[model samples]
Target: MPHQLAVTIRAALPAARVAEVSELLAEAGRKGVAGELFPFAEVTGVHFARLLVVPEGPPGADGAPVPASVVYMSEVDAPLQSHLTDLVRKAGEGLEKVFGHCDGYPTGSASVAARTAWLRAHRIPSAAFYVNTVGRGRQQILREARLREAIEEFLDQQGAALSGAPPSRIRAAVQEHVRGRPDLAWARSRPAPPALWWRIRQKAHLVALPVVALFLLPLLLFALPVWAVLLRLHELRDAPGRDRPDRRHLRELAACEDFGAQNPFTAVGSVKPGRFRRATLTAVLLVVDYGVRHFFNRGDLTGVKTIHFARWLFIDDKRRVLFASNYDGSLESYMDDFIDKVAWGLNAVFSNGLGYPRTRWLVLGGAKDELAFKNYLRCHQLPTHVWYSAYDDLTTATIDTNARIRAGLFADLGPAATRAWLALL
Candidate 1:
């Protein structure tokens, strides 16, 4: 549920205002919280948010430069309208201040309703999105996190007395301890189930794929060979991006990293020319979206699970793309995991970029050319101006463990099951 807002800066605006915008976001990013103008934390249900200005990226295949734009991103609970309403109510001044630099913004005195409409107007729909856990919400994550902490404290205090006890007895004792604490009373009730409409939509999405595939089988049979030939010809001729990122650019990017357990990445690049690459990119994104919505909803994204949230969006009329992700650990490890575990996935989509490392068969050889791939990524990377996280201290793995502990806190279990549950502690 990350909302992407991209508004082009007016060519008429003076350079000083742009510098001011960056400074404002820098202060907020350093604080890791909302500013007086924009109380982002005041907006309910936001797990992560960022504001960054994307400069003109590399030229398109047609030699056109992508215009500089300001992007606002946030991952929040569903019913995004409610969050938007809260944002306008609490941060309207800040919205005006930041977006006012961009074209088509309402005047400073514009009504809240008008500003909200403008925001919705400028919104860009993500082509694909990934959530660490599909049904988890901000409040639930925080509450479960606290539950884990309290349980850990209890175990520390009672370790001697509970020594060698059966897992069931230990679990029962933990339940009793939780019941006695009024602050933890909320966990006594089951969390609300996902809404009926969402469940129906997910099922419909999964069901539609096979039906559509079956309907298109004959078309695919004829198109597959042509597609293969076109892909190979493009792969053979396309220039692989291999130059290292500028040192100053790397320094600016490094300034915003390693400040916490999570880091935000934003990168933008041009799409390759012509209908063939564009069509292939579209098809790949559709397939990726389907798999993420259905098969990968639990936790892992094809066996890599460090990401909290990620999104892909097309810009400049599909001539350019901006990819953003909120992930755990250092950037090096994150890149390593992608290269070693999901290189094919990287190739399937990124191979369509203008200067990507050459790919073979749309899913091989691209990201496998490790140095060139890394350089390609670095060359396109943009430094985030402001990045905020609701639970920066906890990671995807920690969150999953916490949720499991809460789920088993009041459940009945056999010895083996109980032992497994206790091991989660």
Candidate 2:
């Protein structure tokens, strides 16, 4: 029995016109015909319409729906079920016709004839019609009525051919198409075979394989020596037997150490408590605790050489003298102690150097200790600079120096420093 698929008309289509289209679908289902109603909305603006109908039941069942499928109400008066396998095959042709006469009346006799021939060939049983008349006036109602009459006449003529088909089969076919079952649609739209060059091109990468190998050869050759040196350095630095070295290790190991020996008041490593005998002009860097010791050991300073306990000397180097210390102990108890001790010692150093040479002090505190450092600097009336260096070129610095660093000096520096120290580089 042809499946009796329920037909519905939605959108702004009139009640009478919708009933007429639904009656045509009901009659088609009773006569064992199978097809779809291209909703008024789908066909009204379109120059042509196409639909696919498949049989219901288990896969490979005998007379299981027309695997060949059908195309109904296309602009071209093609047969309903030609051996052509896929609806997509004729989509471009249909779209061309739809967009070609975009503004014309859609329900003329010539249009009706073409639509009837396509529907008759497809043997559609049930369909839902929808019209979107969001803006049209009374003229749209008349056009829909004419379209309904034409579609009913076509269904009536194809009634005899649909006689033996079960209504259930028709319903299932319509459901499958509406739900977009590609497997059922696949039999109708058999895809063309791949081009000959497609498979051959997959192997073309082999031809460029040698060139890629050659390009990487020089990089590998150059990288080997540098990598070996770095590996050796890593091994020496992290050797297992060595004692855990402290901040003074580097400075103690090097000979001819010059931590402000060139000028008075300029010291690189920790300074002990003592006054210099000579008329000194240098910056004194006092390392208070272990944290400050580590800051001096960083690569930028090379290594701590000496801690002149007494005299603060000033140097004539173009670069600013930075005194950095660390605060990593207990925040509540030792924090005030650390700040007071460090600040007093730094003030003394700055005061002693003021008479001889100009100097700047940089305190390196951990993330948690920044607040304490800021409060201490604020209380002491010492000029302070804040630096934030993070991912990419997001490094920033704000200096409280009376004189601003010149732009020309920063431009001479590399791109990284220029961006990082935009305020004072």
- What lDDT score belongs to each candidate, Candidate 1 first? 0.82, 0.27
Pairs clashing in candidate 1?
none
lDDT tens string, model 2, 158-190?
557545655443323333442363433322222
Ten residues in sequence with the least summed lDDT for candidate 1 = 3-12
Off by over 4 Å in 1: 1-17, 30-37, 57-65
Q: Tens digits of per-residue lDDT for model 1 on 288-397?
A: 88888788878799988999888888887788888999999998899999999999999999999988998888898988888898889888898886777889999999
Error of 1 at 382 (Å): 0.7
Q: What is the clash count for each candidate, in the order shown?
A: 0, 52
- Candidate 1 has a TM-score of 0.92
Supply the global lDDT for candidate 2: 0.27
Candidate with the greatest TM-score versus the true structure: 1
Q: What TM-score, over all chains together, does every model reach? A: 0.92, 0.14
Best-fitting candidate, scored by lDDT: 1
Q: What root-mean-square deviation over C-alphas does model 2 reach?
A: 40.1
